[model samples]
Target: MTGTANRSVERAFRIVDELAENGGGRVSELADRLEMPVSTVHNYLQALVETGYVTVEDKEYSTTTRFLEVGHRQRHRLEVFQAVSDELQDIAAETGEHVTLLVEESDQCVIVAVQEGPDAVNLFAYPGARMPLHAAAPGKAILAHMPEDRVQGIIDRQGLVEMTNRTITDPDALFEQLAEIREQGYAIDEGERIAGMVCISAPVLDKSDEIRGAICVCGPQSRIDEKRRDEIADIVKRSANVTQVNLDYV
Candidate 1:
């Protein structure tokens, strides 16, 4: 695409993202935030309105029902997460660890659902939390199944930052680890990103045999020792498989 055309598209998307983040805003407010002329913001808003992506009322613009429709479509397709919510709760209860469902959102990994264990723990696995694609176990599991070029692009965009001593700082080493995780059909976070925490994750695949998301169990390093680690991996893989199976019916 031409430079000007790409810039326009980026600006349009920026406007939408800003509105989505702020809930709603007047044209002047949007123009000030976007650092563009009010006329330009009005033109963009008009285009978005024509496309049913945004709606304006009382001189304030907000996302339209069309945006909710898109979100609904995406959520409907996430049958696997819904199918295994109960099973994940069981896993957390059985293991006394946090169980989470993670899905790839563009180049990032987003936690869609979480079930905390009975035991009081410092770790927080709340839904809507985002993690680095290469650092966390669920994110690594999804990334392991992605194409090489796509993985490279993620690394290029979000250069691996050292979150802890165990975090992988080298891109080449991370790729090697991803290869191993793909072969094993699971991934591990050994004190990476957060110190004193360990996570095991397995990928969920659709009927088309495409990786959709991952199921994970995370806990403190003190509880998840060498033996418990293997047990957690096995349970996570089984839970992920069950979720994938249920998606077939849904």
Candidate 2:
């Protein structure tokens, strides 16, 4: 494509991303943000509207339902979490600890599903929570199973930000920990992301043995003592395997 055409496309996408970030915007606001003229922004907005990518509500422009439809379709195609929702809930009930399903997205872990335990303890994880790839058990478990180059790229992009005293801030040390997790078939986050919380996670693989996602059980640190930690790890690994087998059938 010509340089001018590429720039136009880039500007158009920038407008859309800005709208998505701000929830909505007016023509003047978009033009000011893009450092372009109002007429140019209006033209792009009109094109987006015609393409069913943006909508104008009460004179404020916002993303259209088409974007949501696209997101839904994409999630449906990657329905690993949906297929194992019930099994994860059962795991939480059996273990009396919160269970979470997480998928890696651009070096971050997105919680797709969470089932609260029957116990009174509250966990920090929830559906839609985005966690750093190196600070959480689910993130580390998925990272350990990912290709080395990809993992290194993530570390380069998002330096291991320390969330607590226990969080791994050194890249080499973190890589060593991930290597150990790869050998052990599971990962542990001992108050790494949140103080007083502990998470045990295992990787879920598909029929091709590709890492799809991860399943984790999270609870207070006091409950996951030395003796209980082993039991929790066993249950988390079994649950992950069960989910993987189901994914293989599908």
Candidate 3:
């Protein structure tokens, strides 16, 4: 109810994050990992258990299905997500790779929807997965359409954390590529986010020309080589355009 953050609530969320990250943990273990008091952690865990957000079994605390339920409800409420999700399967089938619909959230890329083709490889990407903006094609595609100050603010908050050797860590180099993405209407990630993988993405915009999200296709570099990159890029761009138009009706 207050503008300032409540320390107790922050500590409770920290406990929740620790449990989610490690799958589960004992009260003392969670307290030690979070640098909080044992009794404090125990108290928060009990409250969470009562609320059905967490569970305790054999004195070990872990998250419950409440989070998944909440996430599913919230995801379906987004108009952009609904619009883009419709095109993911088609794009995946056309490219024969993994396709994703992503949006910039809290200065990070968040995958909202994904569809896998017959040849798709399991990667770190999934619904609710977050990654750095400079490390992948979808992020860069969205960043290219953002206001200059907003992009600078994101860089200030997240920094250009390198995910792999091919990632762009230099701010200047990243800005240069963003400019090129603006010109070409798409972005490319060649083993940047993950070694041996390639991604192509296009920005989706609304009637006001504001960025809505990005649509992407990704696969192993062995299959998405230089000769095939242009073709895949066109597929991604077309899917993104269809989603952009669909946003108006949604």
Candidate 4:
């Protein structure tokens, strides 16, 4: 087999992603959106339907639940995710906000677990969601503990695309804040990713002191004022430390 990516496989997955992202589409719709010929799109869609990975209703193609099995299996296989799962609910209960556990993969943060408190704002964040490593508090917390060279490499690959007006786009300013995060043992996001949302996060590390992931508690700005941010930061740090200790024993 060739080491290079298989074009057929790539094309097939792109079709699947298109279906998923758009909810569903007809053959011509998919062809137009993917910039592929209608006949080629039909062939890939037929193959996916036969493989039971996708379904069609009234001539509209949509992805099936097969992806959930794969995603769930891989998430459970992460040691850090396993260690943090048991305590996330308690943290949510204590903070009455949204709690998320994310790990760095391919220089981006991937959410593995999410717990919603009673007062949690309805956010689009979900398991398997991926975002820039510098876009949020959890991502910043994870980056702050990373080696300097590694952090720079990630920045070089994923340029600091400003997600919002407040996002840190300058390398110098980001490094300065990362230093503060190192000293404080936690990081804060003040609507850097989404306006009106504030988050506090702390890194989770293994026994060897390497970053495993990060945990965060997030809420709206009105609820998470300066004083409340400090209190929540303390809670988030403690929860992260507890998860880290649990991982160390594992």
Candidate number of the best lDDT: 4
Q: Which of the two, 1 or 3, has more TM-score?
A: 3
Worst 10 residues of 1 by lDDT: 120-129
What are the candidates' C-alpha RMSDs?
Answer: 4.2, 3.4, 1.4, 1.4
| Best-matching candidate per TM-score | 3
Decoy 1 TM-score against native:
0.72
What are the runs in model 2 whose C-alpha is more than 4 Å off?
Answer: 34-36, 82-85, 95-98, 114-130, 162-166, 194-197, 219-231
Tens-digit lDDT string for candidate 4 (93-136): 99899999999999999999999999999898899999888989
- Looking at model 3, the pairs that clash are none
Clashes of each: 0, 0, 0, 0
lDDT of 3: 0.90
Residue-wise C-alpha lDDT for candidate 3, range 102-205, written one tens digit per residue: 98888989999989998999986778999999899999999999988899888998899989999999989989999999999999999999999999999999
Per-residue CA lDDT of model 2 for 1-250, tens digit only, reads 9999999999999999899889989999999988999999999999999998999877799998787677667666676865575878788888898888889997799887778878826766655579898999999999998888998899899988999999999989988999999899999999999899888999998888788999888888888897888998888888888888888666
TM-score for each model: 0.72, 0.78, 0.97, 0.96
Q: Which model is ahead, 1 or 3, in terms of lDDT?
A: 3
Write out the backbone clash pairs for model 2.
none
